[model samples]
Target: MKSTHVLILLGLLAACKSQPKEKETEAPANAPKAEPIACYQYATAADTITLKLVNMGGTVGGALIYKLKEKDMNAGTIKGTLRGDILLADYTFKSEGTQSTRQVAFKKTGNAFIEGYGETTNVNGVEQFKNADSIVYSSSMKLEEIPCK
Candidate 1:
């Protein structure tokens, strides 16, 4: 009788050990998630520029529109990566019934983003910056954060 009780207790211990804990089977309840889409606009008396950005994992994609005075309006989508406070991407736009692709860079400061310009070389029909480190961020073309509509 004593040996049977000891064997039963040992069997119960093995069964309990084999079962997975409840917390181990459950996923984390506070896992981090990606941020929501953000939109910004820069408007003046004669020009209006809009930008919308969506973050997928670590990559960034969005739409950019430029309606400048006395110039053909260019609108397109941008796909790029944000490194630190700088955003480097390629803009494929349509203007004057023609499509063009060009590299674009922007520097983020506070709630605004400044456009960057630099010398570029046309490579295989795509215009790209000769040296990204030499790009100049201009405050005159700053785009402020705006409510997305």
Candidate 2:
């Protein structure tokens, strides 16, 4: 009788040890969540430009569109990194049914972004700034913050 009781107790212990444990079902309280996208636009009587940006820990991606009088509309996506107030990106766009890629830079001031212009050289068909530090941010092309639509 004593042997039988000991065997039953050992079997129960083995069964409990073989059971699977439950996994964690909740995310950590400090995990990062999705960030909101921002949009901006610059418009005049004869020209308009729009930008949408998503920023995640300084990495950015977005869309840009330019519609100028007597010029083919350029629409594209931009992916790049934001350092302080400066944004350096690659603009892959289509204009007049032709696809093109170019490097673009912008300076963020207050709630607006000014497009940067500089001397460029074509490398492997992609236009790249010759001197990024010498690029000029133009106020005339500033895009003001706008509500996303």
Candidate 3:
């Protein structure tokens, strides 16, 4: 009788040891995730400049439309990385009916993107912004953010 009681007690102890304990804190499985942000910016009526970009984790992908007075329009797709409110990208566009690629940069201020001052280079017979600085806000060049519809 004593041996049977001891065995039953040991079995209960083993079973208790094998059982999992309830966690004091647990996260829900259906938590919502963060979504990427997208924005559209355009210049005022004085200039024909438009930019649309989707920013995910400081990486920017966008399109740029530059329509200057008496000049051929530049419609381009931009792919670049953003660092601390600065976007550096390569723009591939069609200007004067020619397809070309160039480097461009923009500085974020408030809800506007100011064109960064930079030097231009001829790449494959196309002009491009090489290295840039965020020191200049050219006339009718600042892109103000508008609601993307």
Candidate 4:
């Protein structure tokens, strides 16, 4: 496996095994979002997401698997993937569907971790998804001091 993948795996592990952070005292007025460091880059080791969609106020749970790549540090950037089959929920379709997203994760200052947001839309000739037809999302799952096992 590539070193980037290794780093990502370690990062996931770190997120999983770390302790909850207590509210620390406020930093100096000039403190930056992240400690300045060289750019951090990582490739997908393995990634998966579970999402719940509410159409017409009805909730449906769906899951997606992703190949996540990220460049970490303050305002980091991530480029990963989303697929149609993985994103498709239990919707009646007369025709087909398509998944569309680009470079999912991008770093923003003051955010605690790697964050990403994307959407999925399915083409259905039968009926248009009412109430909510699309998914929009983001996540801040940054872990610190990860050493891959």
Candidate 2, overall lDDT?
0.89
| Residue-level lDDT tens digits of model 2 in 44-90 | 99999998998754568889999989989999999888888888999
In candidate 2, position 129 carries an lDDT of 97
Pairs in steric clash, model 2: none
Candidate 2, superposed: residue stretches over 4 Å from native: 1-34, 56-58
What TM-score number comes out for model 3? Answer: 0.62
Candidate 4 C-alpha lDDT tens digits along 8-126:
99999998996989998987666433322222223335432222122222222222223344521122122222232122233221212443322222232331223334443344432
lDDT of model 1 at position 134: 98
RMSD, candidate 3, Å: 10.5
Pitting candidate 3 against candidate 4, the one with the higher lDDT is: 3
TM-score of each: 0.75, 0.74, 0.62, 0.19
Q: In model 4, which regions exceed 4 Å deviation?
A: 1-37, 41-102, 111-113, 120-138, 143-149
Clashes of 2: 0
Q: Alpha-carbon error at 19 in model 3, in Å?
A: 48
Best by TM-score: 1
**Worst lDDT window (10 residues) for model 1?**
25-34
Off by over 4 Å in 1: 1-35
Measured on C-alpha atoms, candidate 4 has an lDDT of 0.33
> lDDT by residue for model 1 over 32-140, one digit each (tens)?
3446567888999999999998885677888999999999899999988999999999999999899999999989989988999999999999999999999999759
CA lDDT, every prediction? Answer: 0.89, 0.89, 0.73, 0.33
Better of 1 and 3 by TM-score: 1
